[model samples]
Target: MRFEIMNAGKIQLCASLCMWLGIVTWTGNMKLHIWSVFVQQSYEGDVVFSVLNEQVNVSKGLRDGKTFSIRSPVTRKNAIEHRVFWSAWLDSLSTRVFGVEHERAWRKQVRDARVVVLEAGCGRPTNRLATFSDGTRACVRYGIDADQVLGETLSYYLAELLGISNLPPLALSKLNLSSEQWASVRGHIEALEWSPNAIVSLTEFIPNVTGVFIPLHLRKQQGGLQLSPETVSNMTVTYLVELMQWSDLIIFDYLTANFDRIVSHIFSLQWDARVMERTTNNLLKTINGHLLFIDNEAGIVHGYRVLDLWERYHRLLLGSSCIFRRSTVRRISEMKRSGDSAKLLCELYRAREPLARELGSLSQEHALTLQNRIDVVYKHIQQCTDIM
Candidate 1:
C-alpha cells in the first residue's frame, strides 16, 4: 500500500508538470532556456518547480497579452499572498464573521450561562446536546477519562493563540449537583455516572453544518495539494477560500499532533485503501462554507502520549501542505523568535480555565514537546519559503 501510494504521488506530480508545460506553451511565451532547465531537472529526479520558474512564465504571459483566469499569478508565494489579501478584504467589507471578538463573546456566554437541559446525541453517544437558560446550545463532552477533556480545552486555546478561528469557542465546566447550572440535569448526570467534581468541556454547538470530505487533491492516490501556478490559476473563489482554511487546519493539527482527523484515515489506508474517499472524521462545514474543527479529544495529551506510533503520518500530512495563512505564519514566527511558546501557552491555559488547576496543567515534558513542535513547524515554513 505504501509503495502504491508513493507511485501514485509521483505520477500525479508528473501530470501536474505536464499540465503546467501545456499552459506555458498555450500562452505562446514558452522560452527555450526554461524548457531546457525543466528537462534537465526532470532527468535529475527534481520534479518540483521553483517559484522563479512560475514567475518567468507569468511575466511572459502578461507580455504576450495573455490573461489568466485568476486575479493573481498562481505562483506559490503570490497565490498565497493574494488569497490572504482577499480574505482580509472580504473581512473589511463586512462584519467579520467568527472574528476574535465574536469568539470571545461566545466563550463568555457558554462559560457563564446556566445549563437548562442535557440530552444525548450531539455527535457521540457519550456527549450530550446541552440547552442553556439563554436558549443557546452547546455540545457537552463528558470524558470517560480526564485527558479527553484536557485535550479538547487545551487544543482550543492553542488554536486561539495561533489565530486559527475555525475551532468553535470552548469552555470548561464542573459537574456539581448543588449548582443551579446542573440542577435540571442533575438526575441525567447521575444516570450517566459522571463524577460530581469532574471537569468537562462545552463547545458552542454549530447548527446546519454538513460533513466535509478531504479535498480531492489531498486524497491518497493524488499528488498532495500544491500551490503551483497552474493549479491556483484554475481554482474557483470558493475553492481558494476552502484551501486557505485547509492550510491552517494542517498547521493546527501538526502543532497539536492531532491524529484523529487526517492521520487516522491515512493510517487506515493500510487496511481500507478507500478510506480517504469518505468524509473526514470530526470535521464539518457550515452552510456558508466555514469549516468547523470539532471533536479534538485526541489532541495534545493523548496525541503526544502516542506520538511514537503516529508521528510519521502526522509529518506526512504536514509535508503535503505548503501554502499558509499570513497571520498564522506571523504568530508562529513570533513564537519561534521569542522562544516563549511554552510559557505563553501555559499562561493562556492557566489564566482562562478556572478548573485548570483541578484538571492539572500540561506537564513540563509535554510543554517542552509542544515548544519543539513549534520550532519544527517554523523550520518547515522556512523550508517552504526557500523553495519559493
Candidate 2:
C-alpha cells in the first residue's frame, strides 16, 4: 500500500510539474529551476529559489534599537527536552509515519464503538466529540469538503514535523451516526448533509484543559488584574507568562504561515480553571506553562494562495508587534550560530513525501512555496540576535 501510494504521488507530482511548466511558459516570467525549486517575477525578491546544492547563509548582526527585554524561559533543561521531542518526532515521521499507523490501528479498534456528538467545535468546522464502540471518545472534525479534511489532516502532520507537542494524536475517521443525531446539530454545521457517512478527522481528546484568556477591562475594573499596554513590554511579566512557549509558538506560526492566532486568543491552560476564572486578562501561571495550540488547519496555505503582499507576515514576525519573548528570539539566534539550523530544518521537512502524497490537492509547487517560507524564517532569525 505504501509503495503504491509513493508511486502514485510521484506520478501526480510529475503531472503537476508539467502543467506548472506549461503555465510558466505561457506567463514568460517564471523560471523552473533544479531541485523542484522555481521562481517567478511576481515573487519579487521576497524568496530566493535555489537547487538543493545551494547554500544559504545570512550574516548575524544586531539590528538597531529593538532590544529584547525579558529573560528567556528556555533554560538548558527545556532546550534539551525540545531537542529530544524534535528528534523523536522526526524519527516517527521517517520510519513509523506517526499518525498514519496510529490512525489505522485506532480505526480498527474503534470500529464497533458507538459514536455520539458532544458539542459544536470552536472553528469553522462543525467539530464535536463522539464516543467509540469501545467506550472511548475522540474529537471529530467533519470535512465540509474533501479539501478541508486534507487541510486539517495535513496540518496535524505539519505540527508534528515542527515539534509541536500541544496537539493530541490525530487520524482520519468516519462518523457512523444516525441521520437524526446529525439533524440535532445540523443548524450548527455549514454542510451537515453535504456528504454521506460524514467523513471526519479524529483527534485524541485531552481532558482538563481550558482556553486561556486575558482579564476583560470590565473585570479588571472590579479588582481583576489589569493588563496595561506596557504589560507585554515588561520582560519579567512576560517571562512569568511562559516565554518559551510563547516564542516557540510565534516561530511555529511564522513557519506555517498561520495568522489566525491573535493576541486576544490566549493559550490553553490545564488545571488552572479556578485561577483562570479570576483573571480577566490574558495571563496564566502553571507549573510548566505549556501552551496547547489548536486549530492549526489555517496554515500551509501562505504562498500557495493569492493574497495581498501587505498581508504577508500579518503577525509579529513581519508586523509591528513586538510582543514575542527574548527566549524565543534567543532560541533562533542560537540555531543560527550553531550552523546546523538549515540542516535540521531540511531533515525535519524530509518526511513531507508521505504527507503531501496523502493530501492530493497539495502540489509539489505548494510544498516548495512552504519551503520558501522556511527560507524566509532563516533570514528572519538573523535579526533575532538583537533580541536581548
Candidate 3:
C-alpha cells in the first residue's frame, strides 16, 4: 500500500515537472522565438484565483477615474512572440481556417472556444478574429453588423454558432459568466463593481468587435492616414474607451509590415527568450517560494511555476485532496443532445452556477454564498423533482 502511494506521488511529481513554459514547438519552421522555456509539465489542484476579500481594493493609483491592479495571479514573462502585419495576413489564414462557409463552421467553433464574441463591425475582416478564436472550443459569437452578416442567414449562423435556438435567454445561459461574458455584462451593469467574471488561466482572450473601430481624428491625415501601428493601437484604445467600458484585456492584430503599435505587450506574446529569462528571474524573487515550478505555457496558466510547497501546505491545512486537478483544463463538456428540452437545460444550468460559485470560492463571503447556493439549488431541485 505504501509502495502504491509512493508511486502515485512520483507520477504526480512527473506531471508537475513537465515543460509548461513553451509555445507549441511543432517544428523549427513554425518557430517564433522560443522564449516560453519555463513551461509547467502539469499543475496540481485547480490553479485558482481567490479574492482575499471584496472589501480589499488595491489603490494602484487612479487614472482617468479608473484604477488598475493585478486582480489575478501573476504569470508574467513566459517567452512571448509577435506577428507583425497580422491584419491582412490573418484574413487569409482565417479564410482557410474557418472555410468560406463561415456561418456554419464558425457557429460550431464558438461553442468550443476559450472565449466567445458577438461583434458588430464591417471594416475589419471579421473572420480573422473568428478563425483565431475558433482553435479552442470555449467560444460563442453573435454579430449584428448588417454588412458583415448575411441577414437571417447570418442570424441563423449566429444562433447555430452559439449552439442554441434563436433565443436570447438560451444563448445567454450558455455564457459561463467568465471574462468574455463579463464584457457583455459590463455593458448592462450600472454600478460596475468588480467584473463578476470567473477566474481564467493565462490564456489570452481578445474579442472581435467590428466598426472599422479606427479613429475619426486620423480620417484626413495629409499623408493619407499612413499611421504607425503603435499609433493605430493607441488610437484603438481611445476608440475602445468610448465603445466598450474597459475590457479585462485587449489584443491587437499582429501586423508585421506595420510595427508601430506592437509594443511590449505584443513583444511578450512574440516569445523573446532574453525578456522571458529576465521576467522569470524577477518572479523568483517574488512568488517562487509560494508556488512550485510547473509546466510553463503549453497548457493553461502561462508564466509562474506550480509551487508544490504551498500546495502541500494548503492541502494539509484545508483537508482537500486534488482529484484529476492537475490536468490543467477548465472544460465544460457540450450538452449531449439527449432529447433534453432547452428550458430544462437552462434551468439546470442556472440552478447549478450559484452552487459552482459557492464551491469555487474561498473568501470571507464563502459562508453567505454557501447558504444562498444551498437555498437556490434546493428549490430548483424540488421544482423539477415534483414535476417529474
Candidate 4:
C-alpha cells in the first residue's frame, strides 16, 4: 500500500509553482471573522465586530452573520478541543499538498459543501458549519467522533433538534440492506434503547452521510506506529506508511451513515479528512464523480501557523528528530528519478521568478513570507536534484 501510494510521488511545493502560473495564488493575509451570536455571551468570550468602521460593541446578540438560524446545528459550551483537532488535520495535509496556496480553498471546500455533508472528526460544531434552506434536499448533517464522550454530546444535540430523545431515528423510508446486514443492524437496534427506523427508515439514508463527523482519530491512535514521526536531529519525516488501507473504509462509512437519502437535489458534502495524513490528501471521492483533493499545508506553514506545530512538535516527534540535513536531499531525489508527482512538486518549488513577481507584488508581510518559503523549498529541490 505504501509503495502504491508512494508511486503517486511526494507532491512538492509545485502548488507554489502552480500558484505562480496562475493556477492558484498563495494567501498569507486574509481576514476570517464571522463572529456569531453564540460566541458573544460566553463567559470566556469577548464580542467585537465592525458595525461601521468604528468597530462598535454588539451585546444584543445580532443574528446577521452566516448561520442557518439562531437554532440549527447542535450547540456545545466548550468547543476548542474539536476546533484544534480539525485545524491539526488541515495543517498536516495543507503544508504538503497545496503549500502556500490553499489558505482560502480549504475553508471554501467546507463552506461550499452544499450537498450531502459529513463533518468527520467533528469535536464540536464550532467553526464554519454548513447551512441549507427548508426545500434543500436532505442536507443531513452527520458528525462522527470516536470519543464516546464527544459522540454523546453530539447525539444529544441532534436529538434535541430532531425532537426525539435517543439516537436519531432514520429520517427516511426504504432502507437498503442485505439479509446479513439487516440482521446485524437489527441487533444493534435491539441492544440500544434507540430506533433509527422510527422517524425515517434505514434505506432513506442512501446518498446520505454515513458518519457526518466520523472521527478517524481512533484509527490514527491505533495506527500510531505507522504515523509516528521519525526524527534524526532536524529532519522529521512523518512515516505515514500504513494509513492508506483505511481510506476506502472511511469513505464507505461516510456513504453508509448518510445512506438515508439518494440526493436528488444538489447535496454537497465537505469531506474534511483532517486525520489520516496520507489518505487525507488522497482524492477519495468526488462530487457527482468529480474528484476533489484539497492540499493546503504549504499555506498553513508559510502563514506562520506552524507556531501551533512548533508548540506541540515535541509530543508528535521522536527525540531523535534532527535538523533536516543535506543527506535528506537524496530522499527527495530518489523519488524524482521515478515519481512524476515529485518532479512536478520540485518544478513548482523552483519557479521562483514567477512566484516572486506574481506574489511579491502583494503586501509586505506576504512578500516576505513567500520569499522565505521559496528559499527553503528551493534548498530542498537543489539538494535533491543532483542526487539523481
Best by TM-score: 1
Each model's C-alpha lDDT?
0.72, 0.42, 0.22, 0.24
lDDT of 2 by residue, 1-388 (tens): 0111123234533332333223211222222222323321122323222222212221111111111222322222212222212212112211111245564576455444445445554445466766554567777766555566665666555555555555556655443344543444444344455455555666665555555553332123132222232332333323433433444555666655554453222222234434435432322222223345665555555423532431343333332222333434445445555544434443433343233333354556556655665555556544432331
TM-score for candidate 2, residues paired by index = 0.48
Q: How close is candidate 4 to the true structure, as a TM-score?
A: 0.21
Candidate 1 clash pair list = none
By TM-score, the candidates rank as 1, 2, 4, 3
lDDT of 3 at 54: 24
Which ranges in model 4 have alpha carbons more than 4 Å from their true place? 1-124, 134-363
* Candidate 3 per-residue lDDT over residues 151-248, each given as its tens digit: 11212222222232211111121324444533444443223222243222111122331212222422221332222333433332223222111010
**lDDT computed for candidate 2:** 0.42
In model 1, which regions exceed 4 Å deviation? Answer: 1-78, 81-97, 220-222
Position 188, candidate 3: lDDT: 32
Model 4 Cα shift for residue 14 (angstroms):
35
What TM-score does each of the candidates earn?
A: 0.76, 0.48, 0.15, 0.21
Q: Report each candidate's C-alpha RMSD, comma-separated, in the order given.
A: 13.6, 21.4, 26.3, 26.3
> Best to worst by lDDT, what's the order?
1, 2, 4, 3
